[model samples]
Target: MSKNKKLDIDLLVDGLTCIDNYSNDGFVNIPTDKSALHPARYFKELFMSELIKDGVSDEDIVAELDLSDQNFEEFLNEKAMVTSLLAQRLCVVTDMPAAFWLRAQSRFDDFHTRVE
Candidate 1:
């Protein structure tokens, strides 16, 4: 597999393992160094790729999501984390369930919390 794909898989596995660890105990070990694989960061890449492939405009997304340009930019730049409301808005645009986004954000946040 490609390096980026491998890293993605590794990070996913680590997140799952962390979930298992959490099930066993309420505590998790938090590291100091920040991770490069934040969900928003990954999402930005996939989001842009899909948008380009589908010939969707950023303006279209903003209008569909009922968001301002600055807000959308923040999300695209990974400066804002996905919340339940944002996930719901995304569901309308991506045709994915809100639960999917929620779970992804949850895993990303959990992974980051454990690492930072």
Candidate 2:
């Protein structure tokens, strides 16, 4: 596998740990909640990084997503949740399956149980 793939997997594992900690505690105070553990978040982060790497600027993504500057800022800051519509747009943009996000969550949980 590529180095980026390994890095993404590691990040996913970290995300899983964060989710577990939140579940055990009453609350989580991260910029985003356990939703970061969602596959969409991972895919979004990676996709955005790749886009930036490929010379796509934040402004470009905002334009492509048809998001207003303020809304796009909120999205980048994780102050606003990604809607299903946005997720669909991302799936189309990245050619990734929406189910991948759900499956990532399931895989993380499964790994957690196996390791514990």
Candidate 3:
């Protein structure tokens, strides 16, 4: 693989893998610095990938997310933490199941709260 292609895969893998960072498949076993991967981060990557694949623009996402520039920046930079409204909007736009997004958000909240 080309260097740039390998780097892209590494970034994708970083988003998908849990903090544990090992997969039985071995191909995805690269480690990250996180101790517990946040679901919001995972959701952001998943949603963004789909959106990019479909050629959705960043401006569109910020509007769909009902976020001002600062807020949107904070949300993405702050682990993609999602609310119910964001979940619905994301689902509607991406044709992804709302339940799946909500579940992921819930799981993330639950784990973080537990740790706290």
Candidate 4:
């Protein structure tokens, strides 16, 4: 990943923890205006990217995730919420800590501000 992209992920993760206290609910209850720092979309994106990198086709990913194309797109767009199960799937597939997404979000936000 590019440096900026990595920073964005870090910011996203940190923001998730900071805003929601890293609750186990899998939903970050941030205000709509604060959505940029939310981890849902970030997690989904990372999950999808990893799956793709692992040679999983988009169709297969959608099927495995039990999501329709439109729904998947909506989730990617941050217009739909993801369940805790989906988060767990991401963590499992990426071999990343379950809390990694939240921390990445936070670090991304912090890095962006520092650079700007």
Candidate 5:
């Protein structure tokens, strides 16, 4: 394998290892109490924790996801909505399905709309 390809595989393995270490169950369990929680923040904590555990940089992940730094920061801060395009882009780095992201966003929106 080429050097970059090998590095990418190694990084992926490291990320998976990090996930295995942190997760009690195989799946990500969304909290039952959705009060005062945005899916972006919730999911970002999960995904970013794994990446950070592997020593991956936010700048690198943002570039890989083709997101502007401001936009990514805003998304994390819940100032920006998770659109279909962003959800799809997120799958590339997060190893999660685009549908999972959209579903989380939908649930979050539903909860907040009801609360309001």
Candidate 6:
């Protein structure tokens, strides 16, 4: 079974007026929040550094992760959440822990939910 982890948002963006303030390389450094990383940007940075920059093709990731073409594309666009199974599969493919992905997804969700 997956771990029943406790989730919390300990630090918030200190003075973020716009999303433009955050760069895409992940981990927005908030003045008040200190150096806490934003989960969505963190994932994007991880994917780029670990996969895209390493010449891991999108199709290769789809096949290796056992994702359908559509699902893979959607994942790229952040149109879908990473299912628990997909998180585990990602751990195999990317060496990132499934728990880490789950936590990132939770944080990402919270951020977007607040945005909406």
**Cα lDDT, model 4, residue 90:** 47
* Clashes per candidate (backbone, < 3 Å): 0, 0, 0, 23, 0, 0
> lDDT of all predictions, in order shown?
0.56, 0.52, 0.54, 0.52, 0.60, 0.56
Worst 10 residues of 6 by lDDT: 1-10
Q: Is candidate 4 or candidate 5 better by TM-score?
A: 5
Off by over 4 Å in 1: 1-36
Q: Where is model 6 more than 4 Å wrong at Cα?
A: 1-44, 52-55
lDDT of 3 at 40: 49
The positional error of residue 93 in candidate 4, measured at the CA in angstroms, is: 4.6
Give TM-scores for every candidate, taking all chains together and pairing residue i with residue i. 0.62, 0.52, 0.56, 0.45, 0.68, 0.58
For candidate 6, give the lDDT of residue 35: 35
Residue 84 lDDT (model 4): 59
> Which ranges in model 4 have alpha carbons more than 4 Å from their true place?
1-8, 11-36, 85-116
Model 2, which residues run further than 4 Å from truth?
1-8, 15-44, 101-116
lDDT of 2 at 116: 82
Compose the digit string of candidate 3's lDDT tens values, residues 1-95.
Answer: 00111111244433544434423321222243423345346446755666666777778877776778887777677645667787776566555
Candidate 3 vs candidate 6, lDDT winner = 6
Candidate 1 TM-score versus the reference: 0.62
Give candidate 4's error at residue 55 in angstroms. Answer: 1.1
TM-score of 5: 0.68
The residue-by-residue lDDT of candidate 6 on 1-116, one tens digit each, is 11222222233333444332333432232333233344344445545445767787767777888989988767767777877988888667655567666756766666656668
